[model samples]
Target chain A: MKPINEMKLEFVSKSSNESFARATVSAFIAQLDPTIAELADIKTAISEAVTNCIVHAYKSSIGKIYITVQIFENGKSIIKIRDKGCGINNIKQAMEPLFTTGGDERAGLGFAVMQSFMDKVRVSSKPNKGTSITLEKNIIPRFIKNGQPS
Target chain B: MDVKIKLTGNTLTACIEGDIDHHNAKEIRECIDQKIEEESPNLLELDFSKVQFMDSSGIGLIMGRYKLMHILDGKLQVINIPENIKKLIKLAGLASLNIIKE
Candidate 1:
């Protein structure tokens, strides 16, 4: 489906940029006028995706992470996070809750959180090429008056 | 993320401020672990009232601390979490973690 609006961003796969990515995506998603809860969900999902690129894909080595956000007229949003670093060998095992190759500092719940917060999540990768994660969610429109839904 | 440690009696409270993410969780974890080693508190309290944002990295932070405390025969408790965070923690099934408290 064609998107009503779209944006793309690319940056170094640094851990610090994790929050940066979230803020950038949140700004673009703001055009949709998401509720606080919906916005938080998207932010959390985006953080997970970006962190995966940093920790698992690039392994803390410098690499490029690309992000694309598209908003649909049907109150839906799709955000794609892509990395050219080492890709996943097993998508299924990787998506499992509490499954992570990143020792110690990782909870292995990146995929799990992405799955939970978004309506749909699609992951694709090539072992030597790269990996990309596409996340989709619908924002229900609300009419507000005096800070309450009308 | 910034962690402020306060040791009172045998309880150590680590006030976690700022955002918790993979990037900063590393530093916060290291700092907290170092303090835990130094104080060897019987109970470690992770106060999150001031945390502005958190993702699964926050969960990882809690899990790592729980494991560390378990190994040291110490106890860990997470207090003053926001509603959204409490939901996420429940989704992670704190019931299974046993020692987890909100």
Candidate 2:
């Protein structure tokens, strides 16, 4: 799809970068003038996706994490976060809540959180290749008290 | 994340600031856990008035603290949860479990 606006960011798979990635995406999406609630949803979903890449994909060792965001003229958004590390063997089980492999520290709710916040989440992975997560959110157009689009 | 603990009587209130994610959840967990061990308060209150962002990791942080308080025969309460963060907590079914007091 030809995006009216797009951004690509690459960073090392480190826990600290999770916040960075979320902030970057949130700032970029701010151009749409989304509601604070909508902005929070996007930031939280991005945080979960980036954290998954750091904890599950990279697993402590540093690797590359790529984030691509595209916004269409209609205010729809598509965000893709990819990691070239250990791929998920079972996407279904992995998406289940409270089924984490990152030990007690992890709540195993990353994918579930993503699914809850975004309109749609699609995951693709190969055993040894890598994992890619695509998130989509349909923007809720804002309106003024005059019953007109802001 | 920055954590400040206030102890009054048997209640301990922890004021947390900044974002909560996997990177700093461990640190936040350890900080609060250490205080719980030291004070052994009967009530634990998590103040999120200053928290601007949180994710699933925040849920895990609260869950870990709740279990700890339960083991100690204490109660856990979450106060001043912003609407956005509250949504994530509810999504985790924590509200249904009554683990968090709004």
Candidate 3:
């Protein structure tokens, strides 16, 4: 197995940076042999993760969010998102479906969507330290009828 | 983003194209709200057939439109949701909104 190649990006926790983060992740994932549907799924998952950091992690503080993307030759992709801000107190409660922290115009579904799109998701947080989310997906290459990759 | 507003009798259709992220949500919001106000349609349909992508900002846009429709006593419907976007919408517990697929 080849070592996974990684890309890292750091940006301010502003709404405007959301698109930048999403686009960055999309371009990184596109290097892999992912289908259009898979690309869309990965992009949406990245968007949700980055948006969560901007909206909930920093809350009212001025901070930056870091995102890392890694892709393996075996078609496995991993994304790690971290924020150096007020961390979540109860990660379990936060992962519960439809349980938003309130007043952020969120549907409490960011984590849920991330989990649904990716094959694996792990979230770790410390009360006053920070929060880190890792997402992994094993991409299945799509093939054309002529025995060529699509 | 480009929003095309069409009115037929009491129904208003908004065809949305391009990406719906934080970058263009404000323009989309204004366009849709303007159409809602000017047409005063009893039914509002948001067509996403041409939309390439959407993020949480798109969810915010939908929520705002839902609230506006509630205030006007009109029905809001979303059509032609792509599979990837459908996953986000479902995960967000927005299926209760009963977005129609075509």
Candidate 4:
């Protein structure tokens, strides 16, 4: 389904931009009126995806990171994060938990955490070309969730 | 993110404040490591009361610190974690660290 509202953002793949991206997306999706936990889940997923673009995609030098967020009438948020940098050679290995090409400093749980929070997490990459990650989740309205008048 | 170090003889408590993410994890790790090397505390406690946000980098931070403390012949404890952050920890199967309130 086409999005009811959408946004596109482009920024240099800087670690500092991680928080920037998270905040921007959170603010934009605030219209959904998600519960606190739902918001936190989306925020964490965004942070992980952006961090991957920074630490893995553009490992050696800085590059551009593209992000698109689309909100649906069904209360689902679809987020796509892409980078035109070093792509993963083994997508399977990269997605495995506790697997890190980035070494010990990385928990290698980026994909796992995103999968845990979002309803769907899809990753596409081409070696020496770039990588793109898409995340989707539906936000349940508070009134329906609580099943009672406030 | 920043850490306020409280050294009381053999135990060192790091009161972390701010989001633990890829950008800030290195700084926090280095700061805590520096303290561990200097003080040689027998126990290191990571206090998470003030932290408001975190991601997988939080898991990495705790795992790396756990290894660090283990190598130094010290013990590490994660305490005062808010409910949300604790959930992330559990999702990562870090409950082995005994991070849940005891």
By lDDT, who's the top model here? Answer: 4
- Residue range with the least summed lDDT across 10 consecutive positions in model 2 chain A: A141-150
Give candidate 3's fnat, 2 decimals. Answer: 0.42
| Per-model TM-score versus the true fold | 0.94, 0.96, 0.86, 0.96
Give the whole-model CA lDDT for all candidates, comma-separated.
Answer: 0.89, 0.89, 0.81, 0.91
Instruction: Flag regions of model 2 displaced more than 4 Å.
Output: A143-146
State the iRMSD of every prediction, in order shown.
1.0, 0.8, 2.5, 0.6
Candidate order (TM-score): 4, 2, 1, 3
Q: For model 4, give the interface RMSD.
A: 0.6
Clashing pairs in 1: none
Report how far residue A53 has shifted in candidate 2, in Å. Answer: 0.5
Instruction: Tell me the deviation in Å of residue A34 in model 4.
Output: 0.5
lDDT of 2 by residue, B3-100 (tens): 99999999999999998888899999989999999999999999999998999888888888888899999999988888778888888888865756
- Candidate 3 vs candidate 4: the TM-score winner is 4
Second chain only: TM-score per model?
A: 0.92, 0.95, 0.94, 0.93
Task: Put the candidates in DockQ order, highest first.
Answer: 4, 2, 1, 3
* Prediction 1 global C-alpha lDDT: 0.89
lDDT by residue (A1-150, candidate 2, tens digit) is 578899999999978898889999999998877888999999999998999888889886899999999998777999999999999999999999899998876788998889989999999999878999999997765664237966
Could you give the fnat of all candidates in order?
0.70, 0.75, 0.42, 0.80
Give the runs in model 3 whose Cα sits over 4 Å from its true position: A102-104, A141-150, B90-96
Highest DockQ scorer: 4
